[model samples]
Every structure is written in structure tokens, then in C-alpha cells.
Target chain A: MIRLQNVSKIYKPNTGALSNVSLHIKAGEFVSIVGQSGSGKTTFAKLLFAEERPTKGEVIIGDWDISRIRQSEIPILRRQIGIVFQDYKLLPRKTVEENVAFALEVAGAGPSRIKKIVPQVLKIVGLSDKLGRYPRQLSGGEQQRVSIARSLVHTPKILVADEPTGNLDTIHSMEIIELLKRINEYGTTVVLVSHDRDIVNALKKRVITLHDGEIASDIERGKYMI
Target chain B: MSFFLSALRIIRFAFQNFFRNFWLSVITMSVFVLTLITVNALIFINVLGSATVQSVQEKVEVSIYFEPDTSDDIVKSAQGYLLGLSQVRNVTFVSAEDALVAFKEHHQNDAVILDSLEEIDGNPFGSALVISAWSPDDFTFILEAIETPEYQRYIKKKDFTDYEAVISKIQNLSDRIRIGGLVLAGFFILIAILIIFNTIRVATYVHRDEIGIMKLVGANDWFVRGPFLLEAIMYSAASTAIMVGIVFLSMRWLEPWVSTYFGGIDFSAQQFFLDNALLIFGSQFLVLSVLGLFTTMFAIRRYLRV
Candidate 1:
């Protein structure tokens, strides 16, 4: 479950990224947030993971309010919510397996569990064979898959993908979308933020449209209608 | 179990980072070694300088020559009085006959000096008291303490002026060397800090993306910082170890040359280092590690906020 009540994020010098945004989604729902550039779509996803605190409002994930999450508690909240970025954000020097294991390692997971879970998640993301390959040795799609695999190491309850397919081609983009759908079907809530209209329309899921820091519409089975 | 795993992983990451950025690590460690060398060089100079001054001080003594007609009782009394003073290290009383014989032996190779010494009738050399003080600075005090009216009347000459000038010069030079070495050490330390700071900053920049990814993937601040901190300490330890090797090897090689150069003064820099090996190298490692840790923490603070 996720809820944002009247969340407004205003930057300095009167720049507002999101304003008066109120939204909620039940568990295990697949939702796509679509907007033009600077339409607060990324900001909304960021709030879900406590990446950006709202200047004024409440952000509650499950039963915990995180409007002003403590710095030390941010990692705890992040481990429960998977985040995928447009950049893939893989450590260039680390191998595919090490990249995924890094997430578990940070959480103080033992070596045996890390060894067991890393391969399993890498298999889910179809990167089981490229365990020794560094990020630079992989394609953009493969690198993004590694990022997704890392995010899944914790079996996060909610997945927030911010422009996950922004750097990928059509086929790769569709592949990432299908992966998200599959993840959602596995009983995990998925929040997809993107400006790609085709990806949104093709999803045919609940769509939330934002315009000028405000949500224009929230429709079940909505198409991309910016 | 998890704590140990995490610690193990952090150490592994530290080694990975160190070797992954091999050239950067080398450059950083080179600067660190240079800093340690400067520190150890200052230590060596201080120890050597102190030993040399001490050796020079030990060789200096004042000879108080008595009047030719002064009684043996008066000279012995003066010797006893000088010996009783806490400032005096020792006093040796040489009778007129013994002084004449020693003077003859000293100049026997020179016929002119031997003939000149033999021309004096009936052992013309007077009895003398040779006085040594625990410290060179205490010589003047001891001499002043012994200059009583009764002893002054019997004293023909007190030969302390030449030794006084030499001791004063040595003390001045020692003070200058110590101050100059300290200033040089301080300058090197500052340069070391700046270079290390820049090194860590550049390293953090190179890994900025990795840091952000780690944080995004739920790595806590300590988890993110652990590797950098450990890497800093690794640099400290490695640099210190290299410096220790360089110091000992160089000291051993130069020991003979140093001894010959100082005219066989009873001072061994190599022995000094061996005697205080733990204190000297241990403190250097501690200081270097503290500096590295501090600089790494400061350099990586901004990047860790991801």
C-alpha cells in the first residue's frame, strides 16, 4: 500500500516539482505514472522510496509515515522498496554477480545466503550466465537487467521504476515492461514512472497523468492521454 | 555471523578498490611514504643530533692548574671540594711529578717539545685537578662554586674558556637543527594532508556513480563508507611498512659512513632506531592512519548522501 496526501515539493527560488498531490494505491497493483518532462512524475516515484522528501505533506508506505524520514532509517525504507533508474546505475567495476550481491552485502547478509540468492535473482533477470562480466561488458539492456536483479535481492514489497526504459530501444523497453508486469503478478506492487507514451498505453493498466506539478487524472485501464 | 560477513565484505571491497584503482592508490601511497620519510628523517636527525651533542659534552672537561709553590694539601683539598658538588661528575687529581711524566710522554715524538719539557728543573709542572660535569651547562656553575678565596689564591689557571665556546656553539647548532627539522616536518605534513585530501576527493569522484548506486540499492552510510575508510587505513599501513623498510635498510647501510664522518663519536643512529623501533614506527603508523581516515571521511561525505 502507498499513499501521498497533499504532497508538495518546491525547490528554492519558487520552483515547484510537485504540488498538492494526493494519491493512493492498494497492494499488488500495477500503476503507470506518465507526464511530460518536469511534470512531477519522477518526483512522485522518488517520494515512494524516500529519495526526495515532500516540502509539505505526508507520504505513507504501508503503515509507516515517512514525510521526514531520518537519514539512518532511509536505508531500511529503501531495502523494502525496489528502485530502478534510467541510468541502470550499475557499478562499472563490479561484475554482474557482485553487483547484485552488493545489495545483500549492504544489508549484512551472510556469505552463504548472498551466494545462494545472487544467482537466483540473476536468473530471474536472465543474467545468470554473465556473472563474471562487468557492467561495461554488457549491453544497455543487460546492464538494466542487472540493476533490476539487484533491486529484487531484497524481495521488496513495492517496485518503483523511474524511466527504466529511457535509455533502451523498443525491444529492450518492452522486455523491461514485461519483467515489471511479471514482478507485479508475483504479488508485488509496481509503480512505473515514464514519459514514454507507447509503454504506458501498451500497459493498459491504471494510469495517473500529471501536468504542471498536479495530477490531471487517475483512470483504471487508462491509456496515455497527456 | 552477519556482522563478520559484513566486515569481511568491507575488507574485500577495500582491497578491490585499492587494486582497481592501482595507479591512484600508488600515487596516494607514494605521497604517504614521502610524508613518513620526512617524519622519520626528522626523528633520525633529532636522535643523531642529541647523541652527537652528548658525545661532545662527554669529552669536554676543565683542568684547574695550581701555582707551582701551592701545597699538596691545598690541591687535594680543592679536588675533594670539587668532587663533593652534585654538578661535578668526577675529579682526577694529578700531582706535579705525574703531570711532568704525562707531558713528556705526550710530546716525546717531538724533540723540541721533549727538550723544552726536560729543560724545566725539578718537575716545574704544577699539580692540577681535572673536573667533568654531568652536563656541559653545569661546568660554569661548578667552576663558580669552586672559586672560593682560599682555592682562588692557589689557582694558577682555569682552562674552561675554549671548551665553553665549543659547548655553546654545539648547543646553538643543536637548537637550530631541532627547530628547522620541526618546521620542515610541519610543512611536509601540510603537503601530505593536501595531497591525501585531493587523492581521496578524486577517488570519490571516480566512484561517485558507484556510491549513488550503492545507496540506492539500500546500502547504509557505514556500508558505503566502510570500504573507503578501510582503504585509507590500508594505504597508511602499506606506506608505513615501506617506509620502515627504507629507514632500516638505509640506516644500516649508512651506519659505518656516519660513524667515520663524526670522527668515531660514540653514537649509533641504527642502534637508536633498533632500540625504539616500536615507539617510532608505531606512532608513525597511528598518525598516518588517523590522517588518512580523517581525509577520507571528509572527502566522501558529500557523495554518501545519495
Candidate 2:
């Protein structure tokens, strides 16, 4: 459900972030993109979400060629793709429920619809118990779960998680991965970018490794390789 | 159904955000309210100044004293001629005895001076025709025309020295009021813009993380901006309502006393309120809302970034 044809992103003259990379992932596939820091993994994820346009070629997601997406249309494109970052970007002042509800509110969701969907998404992320807590009141893992819940409000077709477990401990990281695996099993595509070798090897999903702005390997049932 | 729900959600979130940072919100609102009050007061003062000038113009009456040897018939003919003038609004013939009686009535408190003035067997003052012109400008023209050689045959010296100076002073005062209003309005509006801009910038700084999160989570620009804009409108509307209520109550309470101060002024407080009610309310609403909305938009554009 995703295609990148000759995709390259160069920050400046010398800083080549992604160089002529091409890759594809089918629907409902849980693919992990593994690379070290500055290996163009995050750049690839950003391109998928249309945060930054590809410099050279096409970055297509579901049918939209987002490489040329207008600035005004970025919000609509974002609603179709759920993204999770390392640091949970929850509104600190909002309660756990409000943070999740904000996503639907931005999309102009009805009150009844939001009331019905918010608790359900929070439940899916296993944070149904902490709906009243603020981000500061919850654990790091719980805050991340809120972020996950926020992402799932639209029931996006693709979920792109970039180092979602980066700030968590080993146990919490395992829990987040398990949650993501469950989300993938619900028929949504999952794209995970990480530098954690152990986590990448443990899952043994389709892995694509990047080295110096180029794809080093693409394995069907890949292992984390340096 | 969904559109209204979404607007309500936005409003609820905006209200929550405002109350969450309760002290900061209060500080911002108080600053906004104070600015609005000062601006409205300036406007009121400007309007009041013009109204006073108009009242003074309305009360101004030019006197034309007759010559000692002039006959009543000639004076009566001159009165007919003066009444025919376009600038003349009203003319009242005051005989010498009537003028002296009126003067005594005005000076009744000074009995010692009144007794000295009663020593005269006959009225020494000449009869004068009090001619009222419609406007200050017309007063000068009428006074000049009355002093011409042809009209001078029927009337003696018309001493309009103090009257001329007072009219000119009133005109100058009116001009100064207009300029002062412009300058005051400009200065206060500028200050209001700066205060609102700074406050909104501070708000954005405080919510920087939230804005970033919103941007990341597919919150569109409008979605991110909706609450802040609503907060601005709310602050302005509440402040305007409070100021209007205060102005209305103060005017009502001061009505009888204000009328008592100038018994001949004839401007009823109720009339003043009725005439200016919509103008005052509409101006306040427009000024405050525009200030609120544009300031919010400008600050969002410049200081708020994801």
C-alpha cells in the first residue's frame, strides 16, 4: 500500500539524508526500518507522512502522490496516516481523554462520535484506566500509550512509528512492541523505524536496513544486522 | 450535527485551556479589559466635547444695541430688515426697562449693587435686539452685516468684542477636540495591539509543546488556531459587556445631578443616553472584536510555530 520510486532527500549540498531509495510495503504488513543514527530511516518516515517532501522522486501512500502535496492539504493527508514519535507529544494541560479527543476534534468529529470513539481507542492502547490522568501523572509508557491512542482516533490505514519505544525501558519497550503487533493484526499496515538491534531481531518481520543514505538490505523475515 | 458539535468541542477546549492557566488568563483578560475601558472613555470624552461645543453654539446670542437718538419706529423697521436675513434664526426686542429688570434679576444676590443701580430715576441703558444665529460661523457673518453703514443708521455701536472672542475660542476648542480625538484613538489602539500581541505570544510560548504535538498528530492549522481565536473573542466580548454596564449605570446614577448643575443646558441625561446608545455599544463591539481577532491571528502567524 506504499511505494517510493527513486526517493531522495538532501538537506543541503553535503548532507545527503536519503539517496535514490526505492521500497514498497504491501497492505497489513508490519515492516521495521532499521538503521543507525543519520541513516535516513527517520527521513523516510517523515516522507511517508508528508512532513518533508522527497527531493528527487515520488513518495506514494495509498494512491496519493504526497511528494507534491500542497501545504494546505497536509492535514488531510496526515489524517490517513497515524504517526508515533519517541517522546509522547501529549498536551500536558489536557487530561488523557482530552489528548485523545483532540485528534477527532481537529477532524471535526461529532461530540457523540468522539465520546464513543475516544474511550474505545484508549482501551485499545490499554490506557482505559488512566483516562482522567494528565501526561505528567502517568508513566512514560502510559504517556506513549496516550499518543498511540491519539493516532488511532482516525483508524488510519497506515501506522508509522518512529522509535516509539526509544524513551522506554526494556520491559516497556517489549510491551509497546506487543501493542503495535496487535494493532497490525487488526488489518492496518505498520511501519516502524528503529535503531534497536535486539528489538528488530526479536520480531523477525520484513526488515529494511539503511547505510549511508542507501538501503543496505531488504529481508522477508529479516534479522537486525549492523 | 457534527459541525456544531465540533465548534462546541473547540469552545470547550478553549474554555478549559483558559481556566487551566487561570492566573495567566486573568492577567491577560484584565489587561484587555483595562485597555478597552480607557479606549471607550477616550471616545466618550471626544463625543462629550463635541456635544458641549454644539450646546454652546446653540446658546450663543449676539446683541445689537440701538443709538440713543434712534426712534422705536426705526428700530422696529431695522428689526424687520434683520429678521429677513438668512443667518438670523431668532430676534427678541428688549426695551431698556426690560433689559434693566433682567440684569437686576441676574444680580439679585448683590442687594448693595442693586440698591446703587436703583438710584437712577430713568433707565440709562439703550434697548437692544438679541439676535441668535444658527451656528457660530453665522454669528460672525450676521454681526458683520449688522455693523454696515446702511444698517448703522438705525443701530448704534454694537460691542461684540467679548462675544466674538468667545465664539472664536469655541471654534478653536472644537477643532482641537477633533485632532485630540484622532491622536488619542491612534495612541491607545497602538498600545492595545502591543499588549494583545505580547500576551498572545506568551500564550503560544507556554503552549509550545502542545502546538508541536498537535501539529504532529495531524491537527490542521485551523484546528490549532481555533481555540486561541475563540479565547480572544471571549475576552473582548466579556470586557465590552462589563464596560458598557458600568457606563450605563454611571450615567443613570449621575443623571439628576448633572442636570442640576446646568439648569438652562436643557440636555436631559435620558436624551443623551438614547441618542448615543447604539453608537457607543456598536463602536465598542467593533473595536474590541477586531482588536481581539486580528491580534490573535497576527500572533499565531508570527510567534506560533510547530
Candidate 3:
């Protein structure tokens, strides 16, 4: 479950990334947020993970209000919510297996659990064959798959993919989108943020459109409409 | 179990980071070793200076020559009086006959001096009391204590003035060397701190992206910071061990040369280090670790904000 009540994020010197944004989504729903470059799509996703605090309003995930989350509690909140980025954010020196294990490792999981879970998740993301390869040694799609594998390591209740396919080609982008849908079918709530029109139309899920830091539309089975 | 596992992982990461940036770690450790060497060198110089001053002070003694007509009993009584003083280290009573013999031997190389000495009657020289004191400064006090009227009348000469000037010079030189060494040590420590601070900053900067990624991946702040802190301490420990080896090797190599140059001065730098090995090397390691930890914390603070 996720809710944002009148959240407004305004930068210094009168720059507003998001303004008066109110939205809600139930658990286990697949939602796509689409917008132009500065249309506050990324800011909206950032708010979900407590990466950016709203200048004015409330952000609630499951029963906790995270609009003003304490610094110490940020990590606790993050571990429960899987996040994928455009750049894949993999440790360049770490192998694919180590990268996925890192997430569980940070949470103090036992070595046995890490060993068991890392390969399982890597298998889900189709990265089991390249477990020993570093990020640099992998293709963009493989690297993004590794990132998704890491995010899934915790079996997070909610997954937020922020432009996950921005850097991938059509085939790779469709592959990432397919992975998100499969993750959604596993009953994890998925929120995909992107500007790719074809990706959004093809998803045919609940779509929320933003224009100038405000929601322009919210349609069930919405196509890509700017 | 989880806490211990995390600790083990942190230590592992620390080793990984240290070796990953091998050249950077080596350069930082080299600076630490150089700083420690400078500090130890100053300690050696200070110890050597104090020993040299002490050696010179020990060799200085004042001879109080009695008048030629003074009886042996009077000279012997004066010797006893000087020996009874707490400040007097030792007192030797030289008889007039012995003094004459010593004078003749001292002038044996010069015919004119021997001839002049032979011109005197039976023994022109008189008995004297040579006195050594516990400290060079104590000599003045001891001489004053023995300036009684009975001893003063029979005393023909008190040869302490020349030695007093020499003692003062030695003490001044020792004090100057100590103060100068302290100043130099302070300057080197400051430079070392700056160099170490910058080195840590650069290393942390290189890892800023990795730190951000770690934080975003839900790693605890301490989990992110643990490896960097441990790496700093490792560098300190390694540098300290290297410095100890270098210092001991240098002391062994220089010991013979130093002993030969300061013959009979009772100063051995190697012995000094051997005697205080724990205190000297232990304190260096402690100081270096503290410095490294402090700088690492400061340098990584900004990066940890993510």
C-alpha cells in the first residue's frame, strides 16, 4: 500500500519538482508513472524510497509515514522497498554474486542464507551463469538484471523501477519490462517510472501521467497519453 | 552471530579496499613511517645530547691547592671536610710529593718548564684536594660550603672558575638542543597531519560513488563506515611495524659509529631504544592510529551523508 497526500517538493530559488501531488495505490498493484524529463516522475519515485523528502506533505507506505523519516530509519525503510535505477548502480569491482549478496549482507544475513539466496535471486534475473563476472564485464542488460536481482534479494514488498530501461535497447528494455511484470505476478507491488511511450502503452496497466509537477491523468489500462 | 558475521565481513572489506588501492595505501603508509622516523630521530638526538652533557659534567672537578707552608694535617682535614658534604661526589688528597711528580711528568715534553720547576727548592708545589660533585651546578654550592676561614687561609688557589664556564656552556647547549628538537618535532607532526588528512580525503573521494551506492542499498551507516575506519587502522599498524624495523636497523647500524664518536660518554642510542622499545613503538602506533582514524572520519563524513 502506498499513499502521497498533497506532497510538494520545491527546490531552492523557486524551482518545484513536484507540487500538490496526491495519489494512492493498494498492495500488489502494477502501476506505471510516465512524464517528460522534468515532469517530477523521478521525484515521485524518490519520495517512495525516502531519497527525497517532500517539502510539504505526507508519504505513507504500508502503515508508516516516511515524509519525514529519521536518518537512522532510512536504511530500515529501504531494505523493505526494492529500487532499481537507470544506471544499474552496481559496484564495478564486485562480481554479480557479490553484488546481490551485498544487499542481504548489509542486513546482517548469515553467510549460509546469503549463499542460498544470492544464487536463487540471480537465477530469477537470469544472471546465474555470470555470477563470477564483474559489472564491467557484463552487457547493459545483464548489468541491469544484476541490479534487479539485488533489489529482489530481500523479497521487498514494493518494487520501484526508476527508468530501469532508459539505457537499454528495445530488446533489453522489453526484457527488463517483462522481468518487472513477472516480479509483479509474484504479488509484490510494482511501481514503474519511465518516459518511454511504447513501454508505457505496452504495459496496459494503471497509468499515472504527470505534467509540470502535477498529475495529468490516472487511467486503468491507460495507454501512453502525454 | 549476525553481528560477528558483519564484523568479519567488515574486516574482509577493509583488506579488500586496502589492496584494491595498493599504491595509495603504500604512499599513505610511507608518510606515516617518515613521520614516525622523524619523531624517533628527535628522541635519539635529545637522549644523546643529555648524555654528552652528563659525560662532560662528570669529568669536571675543582682542585683546591694548599699554601706551600700548610701542614699535611691541615690539608688532610680540609679533604675530610670536603668529602663529608652531600654534594661532593669524591675527594682525592694529592700529597705535595705526588703533586711534584705529576707536574714533572706533565712538563716532561717541555725542557724550559721542567727547568723552571727544578729551580724551586725541595717542593714548590703544595698538597691539593681535588673534588668532584654530583652535578655541575652543585659544584658552586659545594665550593661555597667549604670556604671556611680555616680552609680559606691555607687555600692558595681555587681552580673552579674555568670549569664553571665550561659547565654553563654545556648546559646551555643541552637545553637548546632539547628545545630545538621539540620545535622541530612539532613542525613535522603538523606536516604529517596535513599530508595524512589530504591522503585520506583523496582516497575517500575515489570511493564516494561506492559509498553512495552502499547507502542506497540499505547498508547501515556504520556498515558503510566500518571498512574505511578499519582500513585506516590497518595502514597505521603496518606503517608502525615498518617504522619499528627501520628504527631498530638504523640504530644497529649507527651504534658503533656513535659509540666511537662519543667515546666513554656512556651513551648508546641502540641501548636506549632497546630499553624503551615498548613505550617508544607503542606510543608511535597509538598516535598514528589516532591520527589515521580521525582523518578518515573527517574525510569520509561528507560522502557518508548519502
The segments of candidate 1 whose C-alpha lies over 4 angstroms from its true place after superposition are B69-80, B105-119, B148-153
DockQ of 1: 0.74
TM-score, cand. 3 vs. native? 0.93
Q: A21 in model 2: Cα distance from truth in Å?
A: 1.7
Rank ordering of all candidates by TM-score, starting from the highest: 3, 1, 2
Clashing pairs in 3: none
Across B53-101, the per-residue lDDT of candidate 3 in tens digits comes to: 8888889889999998899999999888888888899999999999999
**Model 3, A114-205: lDDT tens per residue?**
98999999999987889899899999999999999999999999999999999999999999999999999999999999999999999899
Whole-model Cα lDDT per candidate? 0.88, 0.82, 0.90
Question: Whose DockQ is higher: candidate 1's or candidate 2's?
Answer: 1
**Per-model DockQ against the true two-chain complex:** 0.74, 0.59, 0.75
Model 3: lDDT of residue A191: 96
lDDT score for candidate 2 against the true structure = 0.82
Clashes of 3: 0
Worst 10 residues of 3 chain A by lDDT: A91-100
Over 4 Å off in model 3, which ranges? B69-80
Task: Give the Cα error of residue A27 in candidate 1, in Å.
Answer: 2.6
Model 1 interface CAPRI class = medium
Which regions in candidate 2 have their CA more than 4 angstroms from the true location? A12-14, A108-115, A219-226, B1-24, B51-60, B68-86, B100-121, B147-151, B201-212, B219-221, B246-274, B295-306
Question: Taking chain A by itself, what TM-score does each prediction score?
Answer: 0.99, 0.98, 0.99
